[model samples]
Target: MKATKRQYAYYTGMFMILVVALYGIFLLTGKSFIWEGDGLAQHYPILEKFYTWLHQGSLTGWSWDLGLGADKLTTFSYYVLGDPFSYLIAFFPKGRLELGYNLLILLRLYASGLAFLFFARQRSFKPASQLVGTLAYTFAGYSLYVSIRHPFFLLPMILFPLLAYGIDHVLSGKSWIPLAIFTGLALISN
Candidate 1:
């Protein structure tokens, strides 16, 4: 029997919910904490400190957390401070940045799956094949670990598959708008 439009959308929603639930199994099992190497030990704290600085009507210009007031710009330089989404880090409380990061990572992983699924649909791949590819890409070892520490870094990855697909369309006589939009997003995200 053929599925109705609502059924298809319901299936998609269920699948996405499953994907997110499975990806965050560590949290469900109590095996996950927001203490990945540099993310926990250093950068997240600096971001929290920076958040406080912003609330005080100033940027993070000094580093009392480090030895005697060093340059904050040097530290901020290593981070993608200008990225619009990166600014969302400040919304998380000083103590809950790790939780915020974990949530962000999970959401990004799901987004990566959706992006890949969209790209595969553009190629007319079978639904099963697209699902397999999406699962492989989302749960790849490198993605799992790196994204845990650096969800911001993974932002560009959500667009990479779409970027390739967009460029492919442009080469194949399709509109260039997708290509331009994807490229612009990737550039701004990085």
Candidate 2:
């Protein structure tokens, strides 16, 4: 189904509204979204170090910070190297990393919804049903759990629907490029 621009806008806006509704309390109270567990201990610190390295213009060298000095790229590749959204950290000011981190979580959730919408459209689902599926997929238990506990995991979740759609296209005898691209992205991201 060819989605109109208006439909795209509607889906995007709805996703934004849902995300804000679900997470607005943090914004309202000026509370950090960093979870008390892995989010605080692992993810935020990695992001901060990444931001620092990015600003320092040296993301490929050894770092004394990683347990008595380790290879920066190899050490962080599993965490942030391949995730495209991680690069956005460079744009956030040093003092506003908490905000950036929270915003990135929200952005990932929003993008996951949109990715699901795209897949649903590819399956020729009705517009209304697409919205429903998108919301359900975005707010699924696993997604919500990982959003805070392990934000990077959301990347794979977001890619899964799109990968499925790519597979469908390939099975329909369409060009295999979409499948290859999404597969490559999934592999690179993780």
Candidate 3:
């Protein structure tokens, strides 16, 4: 069931439109599943502390005392959870919170699209089948389950398909540029 190039292109385009629509609605409604008992609030301060570390490079270890007060990282593990995008957002003119969220959403979409393209290029499945498979991988029960319970994991999930596709292409004797670019993206996406 080999998928023609044109069919793959069409399905990929439609998926992009769907992703954009969903993301736009989420942004406009300012709706998030975040809740008070969610523990997200507890993490905010740790993120702020990491942001400080990204800039200062002096705030290492579990806890450190500043001149004014003592800071504790008792529950915070900076290495695993630190987001580099925090530093990138500081360059934005607008507020960091909104900008950072928007950036994350955009990156998610781009990664999904790249993954779809890679799926289409596989050439083993029909174009329609490839589209359905990619979308299933992107929005299926597992994805939905993760999105609800451990949403932050979505970033790496979005990235996984693209990285797999890029690797597949490189293995199939395609150009190195796509693989190289995706490798760089995977590295910087941390």
- TM-score per model over all chains: 0.72, 0.94, 0.54
User: Whole-model Cα lDDT per candidate?
Assistant: 0.68, 0.88, 0.55
Each prediction's total of clashing residue pairs, residues at least 3 apart in sequence or on different chains, is: 0, 0, 2
Candidate 1 lDDT over residue span 78-167, tens digit each: 564544545666778777766665666666766777777778667767666767777777767777766667666666668889898899
Candidate whose TM-score is highest? 2
Write model 3 residue lDDT over 122-143, tens digit each, in one string.
6677656776777666665655
Model 2: residues with Cα > 4 Å off, grouped in runs:
1-3
TM-score for predicted model 3 compared with the true structure: 0.54
Clashing pairs in 1: none
| Ranking of predictions according to lDDT | 2, 1, 3
In terms of lDDT, the poorest run of 10 residues in model 1 is 2-11
CA RMSD per model (angstroms)? 4.0, 1.7, 6.1
lDDT of 3 at 69: 53
Residue 82's lDDT within candidate 3 is 39
